[model samples]
Target: MGRTIFLLISVVLVAYYVYIPLPDAIEEPWTIGRKAAIVKIGTDLASFGELLGISHFMETMQLLMKFQEVPPTSDENVTVMETNFNSIPVRIYIPKRKSMTRRRGLFYIHGGGWCLGSAALLTYDTLSRWTAHKLDAVVVSTDYGLAPKHHFPRQFEDVYRSLRWFLQEDVLEKYGVDPKRVGVSGDSSGGNLAAAVTQQLIQDPDVKIKLKVQALIYPALQALDTNVPSYQEGSHFPMLTRSLMVRFWSEYFTTDQGLEKAMLLNEHVPMESSHLLQFVNWSSLLPERYKKSHIYKNPTPGSSELAQKYPGFIDVKACPLLANDNILRQLPLTYIITCQYDVLRDDGLMYVKRLQNVGVHVTHHHIEDGFHGAFAFPGLRLSERMQNQYLSWLIKNL
Candidate 1:
């Protein structure tokens, strides 16, 4: 019986090792291949759970990501606190050294496509700790609700609420934070939330304080066109694929499986919302150098029925790239990072162009050899280089 059980377990393990294949076309820097294989296996396991009917993909992925969380390391340079603000959970990291003046404050949002990350995760915790220590700033990382369970707008609301709470005079004074030095930063979907929040705050009548800076790391700024150069060229890259990204968008916006398929084909935008596509038209928005050989093609008109059913697809809050020039010009100093091997690369590029066109102070960094998820891993040489660039920017600007 023991031998039979062992054989069954070994067979299943072998099948997974074979079934979840790594990226076929590996770029230079073997570390990318290693990271790709790890991500592939991790993501595939979540999909496998859903296929087996054990749980939903998001739920499975959330569980898998939970295992990756590590308790905050006991460091003397920074103090960590887990608490709630405005009923929204948050993890705070503070530098231990006494400061003569108010220090800068950063509100951080974790990225997992809005469904698979936590502030407690090692990736996020390490980042918050480093930002607190290196910048000598207070960092508050929000634990926003996940999707397919909480849905769209809920994640945004959580972030906005926590940030508002942190921005209050009492809260900032307690943390010894300077009102003029606060900044917001996040990566990927968290970047989307950061951008959206920044835009909303710019126009918000209730917001008394203007943001000083917004640092976005490979942010997913738009959901309109998936046929852009990066999407077409880097779709098959292991870190983040076009199909998987559309699915993540669908999961965040709605539960309809059909809508997800339509989105993948770039058919969720109806004629009514077609006007908004101009903002995301990569051919016009992207620089010639970034366009390369990819030709632009107009997307087919989408189903009106699906469009009516899911209106969030066209909402500016969900796609910050749709914001007009007036709003763009009013935005604070912005820093954007784009990775070459990422499907969402153009999102950052176009945003940079739009911000610059409107006379907004902008700093843009394009990493030729970088991929989407590398910055989250921290220890890799590539990630470290990107981290140094980010820290350098904060030191100079923040």
Candidate 2:
């Protein structure tokens, strides 16, 4: 029995090793090395989970994150304080120098596929502090609930509540901030929250101060279309795999483990929401540059059962990519960054066109050799330059 079990495990490992979905076209030596290193460490970690009989992906991922260090909590130029926005936890950063003109206020949400992460200086804290000091602005970083425990619209609500607190309170005067220059921004999953809050705020008449702009750094905008070209292209890339992304969303949206795999084929979108697909169709809506030789499938029928079951997906407040023209037309100026090697590239690219079509101004920067998590990744030279460029755009716009 022991030998039989060992043989079975061996066969499974060999199969996974032989057919691991890898990017077949990368030719650059450094990129190949970087991808190889990522794949190696990732393979070891994943294999470790399987060996231990750990079946839940989120728990496995949380274990894998133990390899990273927790960065220092303080910044010399900016004073940091922990506070709550309503009942939700938030950490605020204020620059030391008082601005002659009221400074801009930025709300930042940290990204971790909505499973695990914090508002610490390590994960996404560096850029927020840099922005506060560089732009001389007040920065509020939020702490939202993790998955399998807290789900969709929960994190969205936390972010929205923080946004409302910023809008309703005289935070601008309190922090010497300019009400006209405030904006929200986030990276990855945080980008997802930031964009959703931007759309949700459009109809809030009681909102005392309107956000002037939205900055999305490689955000995952919608769960409706997983088969988009970028999904296929970056499907097997380093760091984020197509299957892993499905697991991420499933962990956040539905506890129905059986439905997770089906949803990757976009089973979550209901047939009734067919009318909404026109707004999010990547094939026709994306720019020619984003188009690869690809096959496009009209969302299969019966997709709406999940929509009918969950319902948060069809709502514009949760998925900004499907927001109506009434909301899109009124959105603040936007800044978006897309990475060539990221699975969600086309999502942001398509949103750029969506905002532009509705007469909203957009500042888009595409990193040709960059990957999805480059904003928080310190090693990549292109990402570093892109981060500086992003902060520069914020300075000019504010």
Best by TM-score: 1
Clashes of 2: 4
Q: Judged by lDDT, which candidate is best? A: 1
Against the correct fold, how does model 2 do in TM-score? 0.87
Model 2: per-residue Cα lDDT over 153-260, one tens digit each: 788998899778877557667877788888999988889899998887877787868898899999988877788988888887767778777777777776776557
Show where candidate 1 strays beyond 4 Å. Answer: 1-28, 72-74
Q: Kindly list the per-residue Cα lDDT of model 1 for residues 42-120, writing each as its tens digit.
A: 7788888888988898887788778889775658999898889999999999899999999999999888898889999
Model 1 scores worst on lDDT over the 10 consecutive residues at: 19-28
lDDT score for residue 183 of model 2:
91
